[model samples]
Structure formats: structure tokens, C-alpha cells
Target: MFTLSDMWTFFLAFFLTLPLVTLVHEAGHVLAARAFGAKIKFTLGAGKTLFKIGPLEVKRLYFMDGWCQYESLKYDKLWVHIFIYISGSLSNLAVILVINFLIYQGTLPVHIFFYQFVYFSVYFIFFSLFPFKTGEGQPSDGLAIYEVIKYGKKADPID
Candidate 1:
């Protein structure tokens, strides 16, 4: 019963909601990092300046490269690095749980709640398994490699 138009609508809605899910997900890392005494630089978003309040940073090609860089700190310790690395995914999962709770309590429509849950769940799993890289011109892919090298060993491999 799904037509091309229907599929397009689904994709459009999914993309539109992605930023919100991403912001909440990234905010998780920002909060966690701050809790551990790391200073957040900025949390950038994709396309046409949604609303910025801090320093003006360079606009990278990949939208997902938008990040909250911390103050100068040593990346020598694996545990600390791992914590920072995993915080974003943790935050996303937290959002999923909150949304799920709302859905359970009948506060959100089933369609909207389900869409958010699935969207965040996919992003969380993907990012957790493969983080966004900063350099090499492949920010998203590179992050995943960095994360895998840094924290993947601490947990099970994605595959």
C-alpha cells in the first residue's frame, strides 16, 4: 500500500526530525563532559544557522561534524576518552527512553513516538558502533574509526 509519495513523506519527516534528535543526543555529551569538568566549545548544527550563541567556528562539509569541542585536555587516558566518546550515544539512548515513557503514558501519538524512537535508536547504534571522525575529510567515518580504535575494544564489535 506504500506509494513513492508515501515513502518520500516518511523520509522527509524522518530527516526533519533528525536534527532535534541529534541535538538532544549531542546535548547528552555536552552535559556529561561538563559534569566531568570539560569546557564545551560549541554545538553546531547543519544548514542556514539555526541559532548560534557562542564562538563562530568553521563550517565543515559534513553536517554531522558539528560538535562541542572541549578545552585543551590530554587524550592519553583511555577511560576518560572513552567516557567522552560514549556520552553522545548514551544521551541519545536516554532521549529514546524518555520518549518511550511519554508514549507509554499516552502523552504522544503512536506514530510520532515510534518515529522518534526508531530514528534515535538507529543513529545511536550507528554512532556508538562507528563514531564521527574529525579529520581526513571524512568526518563522520573518521569519528567511527577513532571510536572503534579507542573504545570499541572495551565493548563488543558492531558486527
Candidate 2:
């Protein structure tokens, strides 16, 4: 039975939950980069600029995609780069754990929003950790980590 209200809830679930999850994932990268003393730019979506605040940008298509870029880390260690690479998925995992704990403890009531949040977080984690480089030559976090560890490959300099 699909009611109009149920349809709206479903739409809101995806539209709201996904972007928040994405922000969490990118924030993880930014946090790790900052820890090693690197400058960061976090861009959400593509197309015309909607707003810019500090290192964060929200574009016209806010729900389409997002990425975080950073300058060289002060540490410049293999482990530091690996940590930064994996931090995004790790951040999503942390949020899932916290939400589940809250629900289990009765601190937060069960709701469709929370469920969708958890679901999308898990979805984000899987794809982000699947090692592969894009045709556009952008290496995924997992691919970057693997390449760094396996080949001692250094990341390209920020242009």
C-alpha cells in the first residue's frame, strides 16, 4: 500500500539521508588531512555554485556527488596517507555504529529516517572501499590506499 505521504517519506529519506552521509564521509577525509596539517577543499555536487563557506562548497546539484581534496600533508608518511584514504568509509561506519547504539539503548526512537540513514551509509561504505580508479583518472580512496601500500606510489601534487 503506497500512499502519497509514504511516497514523500521515501523521497525525503533518500534526498536527506544520502547527502548527510556523503558529508560525513568527506568530513572524515578533511579531518584526517587537517590532522596532518594539510589545506582542504570539500566540494559537494557539480555545476553552478550555490554557496561557499571556508573550505566547503555546495553546488547546484547538491545531491549528485562530492569529493575532498587536500594539499600535501606535513607528515608525508605512508601510514598517514593510508589513514586519510580509509577515513571516509571509517567515518560512515562510525556513524552507523552510533545510530544503532542509540536505537538499541532507546535513546532514539525507531524511524524511517534513521533506517534510511543507516542503509545509505552502508551503501556508501561498500562502493568507497572498492578499489578502482575512474576513467577520469581519479583514484578511489581504496585504490589510492592499495597503490600507496603496494607500490609506494606517491600521490600527485595539488595543482
Candidate 3:
């Protein structure tokens, strides 16, 4: 069944959920990269650049796609790269944890939309961690980390 209200929900879900998820996830990458002394330049979304202020670039209002790209990343160390890649999903996991706490303490009211938001957030977290090989047979962050630990740099799927 389709209705105007359902359409609204869909829109709200995209608008509200995208920003929160993108911010937390991308911030994780940016922060970790900064810690590792990597130059940070990342897109909030792809398309035309809406504006740029210092290290941050705000792209098109499309808002569906975002990725972090570091300049002069240290490729010599496996562990540091692993930390940067894993931080995004870890931040999403942190959000799930905090939300659970808020629900437990009765700070945030439980509602359908909130549950949907949580589900969406969790979905993104797990999807990033899932390690399913892409069409190009590339391993995910979790799987890539495993390969690095067990097999060494030669096993990295991206390279």
C-alpha cells in the first residue's frame, strides 16, 4: 500500500538518517586519519562542490553518497590503515549503543520512526562490517582487516 504519508516517511528517513549516519561515519575516518598525521580531504556527498571551508567540502544536496579520502596516507603500515577504515563502522556502533542507553534512561521517546532510524543505522554499520565481496571481489573493512592480520599486505583486496 502506498500513500502520501508513506512518501513523507521515506523522505524523512532519507533526510534525517543520511546526515547523522554520514556525519558520524565520516567524522570517524577524518578523526582517525588526523590522528595518524594524514592530510584529510573528504566529500560529504559527490557531484558539484557546494562550498569548501578549510578541510571540509560540502557537495551537492544529493546527500546519498559520501566518502573520505586522505592525502599522503602511510601505506607502509597495515595497522594504521586498518584503524582508519574500521573507525567509521565503529562510530555507527557507538551511536547504536548511545541510543540504547537513552532509551533505557527514558530520555528519547520510543517511536516507529526512531526504531526505523535505528534499524537503518544498524544496517549501515553491519553492511560496512559484513565483508561481502564486491562484484570486483573486493573484501570489506572487516574482512580486509582479517586478511591483513592473517595473510599480510599481499592479501589486501583493494591493492
Candidate 4:
């Protein structure tokens, strides 16, 4: 049975935790792009723009989605593309492992919030790593990586 408390938790997880996880995932891509000397734009969400600070933009529907767009990398190597595409999932995994370690060591109290964060982080990783192109013709992180490795170029190159 779903109680009022459960509903509140769900709301919190949906609005707050999920977006934070998404940001972490997107940040991974941005970091990788920066490492490869690519000019990038990182947007968090869709619809009306709430604010723009440098390359990072926050939108009204922040929890809906996020993406990192980068110009051609200085390296421009096959390995660079693969690393950029895979970094998002890797970042989420790193966060999950760190949180789990903290909880296990009794440094952080075991709580539902942390649990939800880890859960959503894993969810992000799984979906991000699942190869598929969206109806809008946008390739997912996994799909992009697969395309680069298999075809040696992104089918829909953002750059």
C-alpha cells in the first residue's frame, strides 16, 4: 500500500534525486569533452530556459532530460569518442560505488534518500548504456559509442 509518506518520498525522488543523477551523468560527458579539448554546451532539461551560466543552462523541466553538445575534439580519435560516450555511465557508477562505500563504512547514515539516489543512478546508467536512437533521431550515449566504434563516425554528428 502506498502511504502519504511514500508519496512524498516518490515526489522527492522524482523532482530532486533524479535530476541530480542526470546532472552527474551529463557532467561526465562535459568533463570528457573538456579533456579532449572540445568546445561544449551543457544543457539541463528542456522548454523555457531558467538560466544560463556560461556553457551550463538550466531549464524549467530540468528533470525531464539533459545533454552535452561538443564541437569536434582536438584529439578527434576513435578512442576519444568512445570515452566521451561511455563517461556518463562511468560517472554514475563511480558515484554509486562511493556512496555505497560511505554507507558501509558508517560514515553516512543509511537512508531512503541515498538509496533512491543510488537506484536512480543505476537506472540512468542502464538506460544511457542501452543502444537506441530516439524518435527525434537523437542517439543515446550507448548508441553513439556503438556507432563510432562500428562505423567510425556518429550517424548524426552533433558537431
Candidate with top lDDT is: 4
**Candidates' RMSD to native:** 6.7, 1.6, 3.8, 1.5
What do the candidate models score in CA lDDT, each in turn? 0.56, 0.88, 0.73, 0.90
* Model 3 segments more than 4 A misplaced: 73-76, 132-159
lDDT for 134 in candidate 3 is: 58
Query: Model 4 off-target regions past 4 Å?
Result: 155-159
Backbone steric clashes in candidate 4, count: 0
- Stretches of candidate 2 off by over 4 Å are 1-5
lDDT per residue for candidate 4 within 43-134, as digits (tens), equals 89889999999999999999999988887688888888899889999999999999999999999999999999999998999998999987
Candidate 1: which stretches are off by over 4 Å? Answer: 1-15, 46-51, 55-65, 73-77, 131-159
In the predicted model 3, the residue pairs found to clash are none
| Candidate 3 structure quality by residue, lDDT tens digits, 122-143 | 8777877776765556666677
Clash count per candidate: 6, 0, 0, 0
Indicate whether candidate 1 or candidate 2 has the larger TM-score: 2
Task: Compute the lDDT of residue 66 as modeled in candidate 2.
Answer: 81
